[model samples]
Target: MSALGVVGGVLQPLLVAAGAPLLVGVMRQVRARLEGRAGPGVGQPWRDLRKLLRKEAITPRGTSEVFRLAPLVLVATTLVVAVVVPFVTTDSALDPVADLFAVVALLALGTVAVALAGLDTGTAFGGMGASREMTIIALVEPTLLVAIFALSVRVGSTNLASIVASTLHDPARVISPVSLLAAVALIVVIVAETGRLPVDNPATHLELTMVHEAMVLEYAGPDLALVELASAMRLTVFLGLLANLFLPWGIATTATALAVLGGVLAFALKVTLLGAVLAVGEVFLAKLRLFRVPELLAGSFLLALLAVAASFFLA
Candidate 1:
């Protein structure tokens, strides 16, 4: 691996893992400010995780190792994506394996692991949450794949680094019909995948409406902390991908220290801005009914399809 790749591989995951909680805190604080409420401070998530780590570990009766391992798998998959994706630099450590399909499959594996963990619990809420999560994932994975695939079509490569590097070279493509449609499609799927507003509310714990929370209702202590941290990292990863793929202006093309530092700063600013925008928008939107979520995802898939068509016809 190149020196840039090695540096970025180490820096990117560390940044994502540490900053993920801060990102969540920022979103929550933004939403709270908009709604005229006193919000938990931006450090609150980090505080919560620290507290959870100190608590006693608990495993529910009758649960299998799936319940024990899902959190680790979820975190492991997200960290792998962080290391491989072109967030801090245009190059990545595992560049050869950074194919779009591989990254997407890694993400899907994490989702499946969590769902299986829910099923292993054998509780009514866990089963219901798993079923609902599966339903959402069925729609989400396709839109995500096709949407990113739309971008890959133009570059003639499925490797994510190549696509980002291509966009970095030709910035105008960001305004093309293909990019716009794919951006919208990606944003929708990111929302769904991260359990955000208008799909699944991160703050809601009402058994009747919660999707992600219900699945982890049986978890406590360190396992719960891992799940929560993994969820936050997934959000950061999705936002980082969305930002860098379409707006790769400040990413480092060189291996120099100054360039890499600038890239990291730019990445943080862009993702924070996007997170704030999402939070503000959520204040104005309500959760869609469970059955209607597929409709929204379907709409995103249609946009991605049109984008793919446009990429070919307009090329």
Candidate 2:
């Protein structure tokens, strides 16, 4: 890799970590506009992070060390995942260790850590949220894996960079029915995994309706900020994968300076459009009852399975 390419790889995760909260802010603004209400500015999430960082951490009396360490683990895990996923191009520096399966495993590890921390707080709400989160992960993860497998089968590898490269080599892959179905499955997975509408409401402070927020209720100060930022990063990572993998029209395959710039611009445009679509979906759909979550995930699973089968048979 050239010096610029090396520098770009080093900066990739930081850019993703920073871009995530901004993405969430933009989605909120879009949703507000769609609902005919005044919206917070796109920089709102940044302000929140700054404020949270300046506050003091207040640990629950009954909490264990896991509670204090969870945020750090969460943030680190998310950064690792961000590095693994190719946003602007298919030549990530971490590609050797950034297999699609490894990415999923790291995500699961973070999820488990956060869930255990939630239970460690000894709060009924926290435990309940943890239970709900585990349930959702159990249902959603398989769908995510299967959808990825659909793409992997077509490319003959489980590496995200390879998959993106292969897709770029054959532009016609974008319009395949299997690709479309996988995209749909991934969208549903994104909404559910990111704690968005019809799955969990990020805006809600109500304990009964909160999944992610409830789990982090005891976290404060920088710890809270880390957890929140990690959640935002998770959203960005998923959307980036969805965009770059399925519709990687403008992504850079070469290490040229001009290609890198174009790739960055293309990445921004794809993420912006995806965020807007998510915001619109949230505005139109009501949050599903917690019990109904299983049904929604089940539908996604079936679609993903069909997608995999179709790709195997057709692509």
Residue by residue across 1-315, what tens digits does model 2's lDDT show?
444435457666877887888998899899888878898899999999999999998999988899988888888888887766778767777766568889888888888889999999999989998999999999988999999889899888999888888889898988898888888999999999889999999898797799988899888999999999999888888898999988888887677878878878888789989998888888888989999999999999999999999987895
Specify the poorest-scoring 10-residue window by lDDT in model 2: 1-10
What lDDT tens digits, residue by residue, belong to model 1 across residues 2-23? Answer: 8888888999999999999999
Residue 247 in candidate 1 has what lDDT?
98
Which ranges of candidate 2 are over 4 A from the true structure? 1-8
Candidate 1 lowest-lDDT run of ten = 200-209
Number of backbone collisions per candidate: 0, 0
Question: Residue pairs in steric clash, candidate 1?
Answer: none
* Candidate 1 off by > 4 Å: none
